[model samples]
Target chain A: MSNRGPADTPPSEYEDEGRERLSYVVGLVLALLLTTGAFAVVWLDLLSGGAALAALGLLALVQAVVHLRYFLHIDLARSHRDDLLLILFTVLILLIMVSGTIWILYDQHIRMMA
Target chain B: MTLRGIVGLLAAAVPGTASAGSFLEPAGPIASAQFSHFGVISALMLIVIVPMFVALPIVLYRYRRGGKGTYRPDWEFNWGLEVVIWGIPVALALALGMALWKHTLEYDPYRALGPEPLVVEVVALDWKFLFLYPEQGVATINLLALPEDRPVTLRLTSGTVMQSFIIPRLAGQIYAMAGMQTQLNLLASETGDFIGRNTQYNGLGFATQSFTTRVMSPDAFAGWAEATKAQPAALDAAGFAKLLSPSVVSEPVLYGRFTPGLFGQVMARFAPAMVQGHGQAGMAAPPAPHQGHHHMPEAGR
Candidate 1:
């Protein structure tokens, strides 16, 4: 057999290493920006009441996505399909429990008001 | 096969001092419905639990080291066994969820059980419950009186910390919180004395924070109300201030007269604006004649 060594390694692995390091820096910047933006909206009184709430909620969603993509290395790639499906299933279960609780409480509230 | 016999058997099997206060011996429609719901849920859970328990010893003995049981070392997976293991629990859970949802709606505590409900304002203090009959213009400490077959609405609030008000024989527990009001509607099916208590632990006197609930005939209830109104004790601002101090009252105290709008005053202490608006609206609206008597005077500003 011919010599099989580091020379035989694919070029994509080196590119992947660079991209992986870069992804963490990018994720950190995005997370900090989102957090600062949320704090600024409240501290500087940039938004009020429901608008402020909506902005904070949006920033939180984006931050979650950044953490998942960079730290957890979860994405739409075929190799990550199992992890994505697992997260979706967990989310489904959470939504069912939370929404069911809210629905029951709200219905009880309405009946009490009546 | 009688319902009484079944309930009796269940009560005997359960290791508790069964008394008039027992939810297992429900005295009202709501409590009875709750009891049935609990029974159904327990039976549903046992469908899975009982079989696993029964099979444990049998499987252990048969598959022991020197036993003559057939063993398949190469066995990996079987579709039939997988279906049996997963399918039953999923189906049972779905059924249980549907049942719970249906019953929760049907037996909502706030839902009026009958027409002409007697409205009582309940204030849970540090270690006692004060029941004010808004309609009857009387109040009592550590006692609740109701007319059998007639619906009774209790509007509850907590003067100190949060507490849970429950008369297990008559209904389930509903929370009482400071600054907020919760409502419970109940109707007694028969005349009897039940026990009501604050289930939430608040302070040193939590254990003795219980009241007697007397369900009597309509005529008897009216007479009791009239007699209570004739008592010498009056609950004014001074008396109320004394009550605010945490203490366990050994005997039920009856007040011949209470300051009008006392309940509103308690509510206003925490949420002034909301209580003011509510009090004003209630005063402005003309009372429906068909509704039971309401003697609430103008709320203290």
Candidate 2:
């Protein structure tokens, strides 16, 4: 093992400057395609209601992954495990709070109408 | 001579001190239920809170340096201690969550309290409330008079910005937003004067946007409505336009006559699509013919 800490060590892929730039360009194109697809799905009335929602949600998820991998340089590599874990933990906390609130409020709404 | 004694004396001197505006001294069934709900929540919270406070000082003194408490420097996690520390809070949270869900459903503001409700169309304006009695063909600014023992169904909408309508002694607060209708059902149990107000801060005159809620016997209510209808003022389009201006109303203004379907017009102002098929200037929709039970024209949004 190397004496250098994880923070001090350079990522192997980033050592190739051309490949790093190519990854960014690829991520940008994919992000733009996904965004345009989402807009088209809504604007062109390609889908309605739940179907439309699901399609948009799928595109958004893809865009988020692309951004994370390219812009934020977060990935599933061994060196990036801490960053991924931190983000996942944050998402878990937000999901717990937001979903808990919605569940309670929606339950109340149904009961109120009943 | 004591501070507590002086406070007690002063409290006694103020007649009907907390009774008029406090949910703690509830004047209605809904408010009474809310008051008990509050009591229950507080008591449950105190079960956890009180112990923490009581243990804090005791723990500090017992574990202080050179004290009689056991000095276990090498001590690690104990399963029994861990369970106890986590278990109590988890159980308390579950209990509180269940209680909140149960009570929220039981006291829903939209749920009708009783039969044969007295309908009151409420419009929240800048620094004031306009209440229209569709059945009586009369309207009042900054005043809400209801017959005791009869449920009052309030269909609330805001004429300008968003506002919250609250009559603490009667029921809980409900939001009123421009172009959207919200409903609240409440029934005063006894004849008395309670305070009502817009709890949401909108602009400069928000502090003064309060109204007097008078609950009286059915017979007295009828008489008062008749007396009010005999007043000269009318809530015509021009008068309503004037009321739209931001100002604090010091005294309640009673309008004997008001334009029919005025409530719908106010709601339609924000949502023009609702009035699209009417084939008239949105403001000039034909006056609805007076019926025994005058239902406010629906703004089909």
Predicted candidate 2 versus true structure: per-residue lDDT over B1-301, tens digit per residue: 2433444366668886555687756789998778777767777898889989999999889999977789999999999989988999899999999999999998888889888799899999999999999989899999999999999999898899999999998999998987667789998998988999999999999998899999999999999999999999999888998999998999999999899889878888885543444322211111212211222246542
Query: Which DockQ values do the candidates obtain, in the order shown?
Result: 0.07, 0.07
TM-score per model over all chains: 0.74, 0.74
After superposition, which runs of candidate 1 have C-alpha atoms over 4 Å from their true positions?
A1-114, B1-4, B10-18, B276-301
The segments of candidate 2 whose C-alpha lies over 4 angstroms from its true place after superposition are: A1-53, A59-79, A87-114, B1-19, B73-76, B274-297
Give one clash count per candidate, in the order shown: 0, 0
In model 1, state the lDDT of residue A36: 96
Ten-residue segment with the worst summed lDDT in candidate 1 chain B?
B283-292
Model 1, range A11-112, lDDT digits (tens) per residue? 777677677878888899999999999999999999975577778878888999999888777778744677788899999998889777766654433332
TM-score chain B for all models.
Answer: 0.88, 0.86
lDDT of model 1, residue B13 = 90
Tens digits of per-residue lDDT, candidate 1, B95-211, equal 999999999999988788888899999999989999998788999999999999999999898889999999999999999977667889998997988999999999999999999
DockQ of candidate 2? Answer: 0.07
